[model samples]
Target: MTMSEPLDPNVARAAKLDTATLSDALDKLGIAGQCYRIKPRDVNFRMTGRAWTLLYGPAGKPCGTVGDYIDDVPPGSIVVLDNGGRDNATVWGDILTEIAHRRGIAGTLIDGVCRDTALCRQLGYPIFSKDHWMRTGKDRVQVEATGVPVNIGDARVAPGDIVRGDADGVLVIPKEHESAVLDTAEAIEVAEEAIRNAVRGGMRLDEARKQFKYHQLQTRQEG
Candidate 1:
């Protein structure tokens, strides 16, 4: 199917995870499925708090720009927008980042380009997007609706799903699957840490890996 094909972004299921546990989960999951943060934004806006999900469109002309969602987002929620991969136009800018941060929004994940990198950097906002651009999304695009399904890489994200991002990248733990995945991922992380200690203490790679069975840990078990 095309990336922009119609899809329902709904909280068909609810997922929950605490901040302290999620860190452990990500550690075990390792760098995966996320957009591999090539270059970081300097904006001082940070996605404070633990885990908050923002469900959106998979493409199909999602309504509202990055700014429009800022007002509606609750504290600690992420602003995930779908702009189809039109890397030529920029959908997010400095003003939106500032507003989102003040509103206590966690961060933003854009399927398109962003503008005002230096401003974003200064504001300390964490943005995961396709590219950075100097152009504004004026006539280029506009939101057709809010709270819809948007394609973020290989996954489908909806409102209330757990979206976790970091220096590695971003991962969407479906609302239905988040709790189980988080639990499994935590155990995997602990085992990996044990392996890390083994390596640091002078054990051989194969020996340490075999002792931990690192290759066998599955963080996300598709149900």
Candidate 2:
């Protein structure tokens, strides 16, 4: 990568905003992007990248491997693993964490759980999941497909969708809605900042909010 190549505009824009602001933007547009229950391994962790989705399911008589797909994920992409929110098995672990950190991968978001929490934290690699456990998914769950649409919490994340995560949690912005969502999120951020500035300058909280239209920022609009 050189000056000849430009950063992805959506990715760049999403990086400036947190998941909370983005969530509000999603609501204002009536788009479902908030992922419920999923949380970051560390509150300080943050990541923004396009999603490279993997769907997992209960293994058959002969189980499949859990990590081969990590090699195929492009650098700067978020690996989204959907295991049907199964806590009994772990689809991610130490090996994958080390490899992803070395490969320049943005991070990993699992709809289920991950293992090797110490390794991930030590490596400073971002991982957002329902929980972490030592159990492995090796003989329990198998990859149903790669580069496919998957569910993360209550949100639907398609391959190539913008996946951003922070201390609050993770959220997916569909590729088709990325532009609008980013625009709306930026506006909401601006309005909120204005409200804060007003308060700092001596305006009442309610007055500042009203002046900036803060209350209506996340309200859905009519078509």
Candidate 3:
């Protein structure tokens, strides 16, 4: 099945690469402006997660949870939280992490603050947050619309967007581009490995670079 169609959780989890591989893939692909992840990091785990975004309002009728929209949400759903761009209230907490872990969830993303930060880290669940705090959001805010388009920092996420997060922040891979990104990422990884090996074998940087034409190769449109 294509990425635009429903993806198997089993397949997604299998597609998850280690942090080293992911970083190397990013480096090869020349994707930048990401890193400096949240504190008390766990570098061991990697997540292959999908977005279930939500907008929010205070005690309103149109609210839900990381679990509500994703209760039966596939095991790899990332639960990307977008509380109307507010970074003050808690959108993720210990219980949420516990729930996610139980359900085989890949991870969580808060484009805002999260409470029980220590618990999340303790469980070794990957959560990308804009900030951390102890404030409760149950009274102040609740989800307004679930599985809708929401903005996380500069990235716009829909229900099925692949949200990959590790010790190096999150990369929003649109559902439309999942196959392209994944395939290109692997290709980049292959080229990067070749370059690294050449560099170690007494080949100078400039000569190897000119010989490989890596820059031109990655930029060329693939049919």
Quality of model 1 by C-alpha lDDT: 0.58
Give Cα-based local distance difference scores for all models.
0.58, 0.90, 0.64
Report residue 3 deviation for candidate 2 (angstroms).
14
Where in model 3 is the C-alpha error above 4 Å? 1-45, 58-72, 217-223
| Cα lDDT, model 3, residue 70 | 49
Give the per-residue lDDT of model 2 (tens digit) for 1-38.
Answer: 62111149889899899999999999999999888999
Model 3, position 212, has a per-residue lDDT of 70
**Which residue window of length 10 is worst by lDDT in model 1?**
3-12
1-223: candidate 3 lDDT, tens digit per residue: 4222226653364255433444444444554413234322355545665677777766655543433454655665777777655666887778777888777777777767787867767787777777777887876786677778877776677888766666555666666655655666666667667887899999998777777766754463534
For model 1, how does the per-residue alpha-carbon lDDT over 1-223 read when each residue is reduced to its tens digit?
2211112222111122332345445444552333333223532322322233333323334434433556666666667766666677777888887887676566778777788877667666678777798888765676655666556664566676666555444666666655555666666668778998999999998899889987766443333
TM-score of each: 0.72, 0.96, 0.76
- In terms of lDDT, the poorest run of 10 residues in model 3 is 32-41
Rank the models by lDDT, top first: 2, 3, 1
Clashes counted in candidate 2 amount to 0
Instruction: Give candidate 2's root-mean-square deviation (CA, Å).
Output: 2.1
User: Given candidate 1, what's the lDDT at residue 6?
Assistant: 16
Task: Report the error of model 2 at residue 115, Å.
Answer: 0.5
